[model samples]
Target: MSQLLEPFREAYRNMELLPLLTETALKKFWVEYGTETIEELEQLVEDSPSGDSKIIFAGHRGCGKSTLLAQFGRRMADKYFVVFFSISDSIEMSDVNHINILFAIAVRLMEEAEKQKIKIKPSIKEQFYKWFAKHTRTEIEESQAGVGVGFDLFKIISGKLKADATIRDEIKQEFNRKISDLIARINEIAAVVQGASQKEILVIIDDLDKIDLGVVRQVFEENVKSLFQPNIRVIFTVPISALREVRMAGTLTTETNNQIVIMPVSKLFKQGERYINNSEPISEAIAMLTDVMYKRISRDLIEPEVVKKIIIYSGGVLRELVRITNQCCRICLRLIRRKPDDLDIKINAEVLQEAITNISIDFDTRIGNADYELLQQTYQFFTPNDPKEQRFLDLLHGLYVLEYRNAKLWYDVHPIVTEILQRKGKL
Candidate 1:
């Protein structure tokens, strides 16, 4: 019984160690994995002597955009001026109509300049920081204000800045011109920083794609593309769904799509596989996955084969793979009574089934009304026993629904969604 319970115990211990599997977790393990992409981005930064090229990286969610951006940030910190900001955190559509995203960019530039020991004008610096603090903490403040909050205060400030006659007529005049004014302000800040340090500023907007689709379009089309200056280079991540939405809306032209680069995480994994091939194709993929997974979550409780199962179940989606590994760890812990040592125990078909069952129960309980229909359709189309459903299951796995193991796929609804479906008799 002790031997039988060992794998379960170990899995449980692994889960205890990893509660949330995010890009940060992956970075802890595979520091060297994204070196090439970082180098390419660095080269892009280096080649732009004038410092004004915008780069958009679009990919599916959980495809490691944030991780790649973090890697780029680390590499460029010493070489060129770099400020990483997420627009989703700092700006909203309503906010955008008031103060453009360029304000966020300006704030990021100021912070990075301060970090690099570049001296900025004290008053200008304080004003930028204050504005940034206001914007960054907007959500919290709105919640605190409760019922009486209005856009009037924000408009008053904008009016004051615009009506200041002593502030150069051109500057004040430019300030009132909507998005263009924001760009001018960002350029002014960039110019000030550049004058002090003689370095070009690269503002990286990571995870912009993770926000609402409409907002994503508004930022890129209305603010970013329309108002950007030549001296401030903006790099941001675009979500694949946003791209599809833009295409469907007939807003994304061929030229715009060409400007946006799609970096598939699967391609990176394939490259890693080549670098670490042993004998068999399946063995090589599994081995590479184990090394990668162990690096992300450590190799204390889970075994290589179990990691392989997680990866196969993940359908090459890095986020899903980490999530499954993390979940399995939790499941094993809940089932076992004692600490287990072996991290190489097999996560057989039976264990996989059990995990999915638990996951389904958890998923159904959490999903909301708006997402119910989609979740139901996904489960009905991706059953494990049907060969005809493989493609749909693979897509679902890519989207992070099913887990891939031993080159075979396992179907499980999200715990919150699963509960809903069960109640509806759709499971």
Candidate 2:
């Protein structure tokens, strides 16, 4: 038993002593690195209560949307009645109709309101609970009993409610009315609270872009548009790809048109820019991001050099930095058995080279049929000095693989990804 304990103790101590290669626990570290965006979001919520505006936060995957939401939640908790919801984990958002998404938003908000000790009128709360329960029941029953009962019930409800020409129209109108009424009730509560304390209500919808692209469009273009109100401020995360999809769909409505604020991750990291009106240097931005990664991993595996490598690889994307750091740390742990001294902990160029090679190979395999073709095209058309080369650099920047400092002068791909590409002969 003592022998076994000795090994465990040694491992723990080694972990403490070792330099971290990557960020493993990003959510916790986010508190330190997310100040700029959190402050901006707080300001937006504060100012939006007096006007009608919407903020659409757009970034690549792993760009710290969840972290931003968590930090913003904390910042707004004191003054605003903040309700946070993330749809990334829900399968319904990917496949089912968006009614479930609305129901989810209401349920999450009500729960949050309760947690915050906000006194919601009992009648409104009860009605909302019942509506959510019924909606959930309908969804479950439909899934279990097949579409026959669901379609029949839908038709029955439509027929009974219809004073219009089509059952479909009737059902749509009824759903819309219920949703509107719910939003109105929420507004009423917000208005009363604002009158009392001059505070506002913020509904933070994180991971909006993580859902199915189609559902995202439906929610923003159709459902969410109707739900927007002056007293209610919404901050939703959107993928850059999804934004392009929205633009392509031509579904940008009047309500969503000018209200859309593309809050790029780059904006928060800009040099010398204060939250209110200042900018931070590139060095400061990198340092903050490194601190964030260090905190996330409990300072267990990442070292300063590794953080620098991750920052370079991340192409100025916070999320990418965190992810690459996390991955590298995991790789390092798997490779070393008896945990060597400080020398062993250092993630040298070789380790990074290996990681990048594997990643590039994985990417190539993922793009199977087009791997060779794309590589050839990339090599032929991608001249480092050409303007088109800058576009390619931008593409890599968008992918969080490389950062663009100037025209065609770009840094190397993340050590991990670069290694992979080299192994695959694509570099």
Best-matching candidate per TM-score: 2
lDDT of 2 by residue, 364-384 (tens): 454443333333344333323
Q: How many backbone collisions does model 1 have?
A: 28
Every model's TM-score:
0.62, 0.64
Scored against the true structure, residue 242 in model 1 reaches a CA lDDT of 54
lDDT of 1 by residue, 1-427 (tens): 4453755454444433322224554455553444555666666667765567766676656656676786677667676577776655554423332244455465556555665657666556556545543433322232322222223333333333333333323332445566565666677878888888876667887766655555665656654456345467777676655544434224444423344555554422321232244622355445555666665454545554555556655545556566566666555554553435543344455566576566556554544554455556655654434323433323343353433222443344433344446778765
Model 2 ranges off by over 4 Å: 1-28, 31-36, 49-52, 89-91, 96-98, 120-125, 138-198, 222-224, 227-231, 245-254, 263-282, 296-304, 336-346, 368-427
* Residue ranges of candidate 1 with Cα displaced over 4 Å: 1-27, 34-36, 48-50, 91-100, 123-177, 222-224, 245-257, 267-285, 296-300, 336-351, 360-427
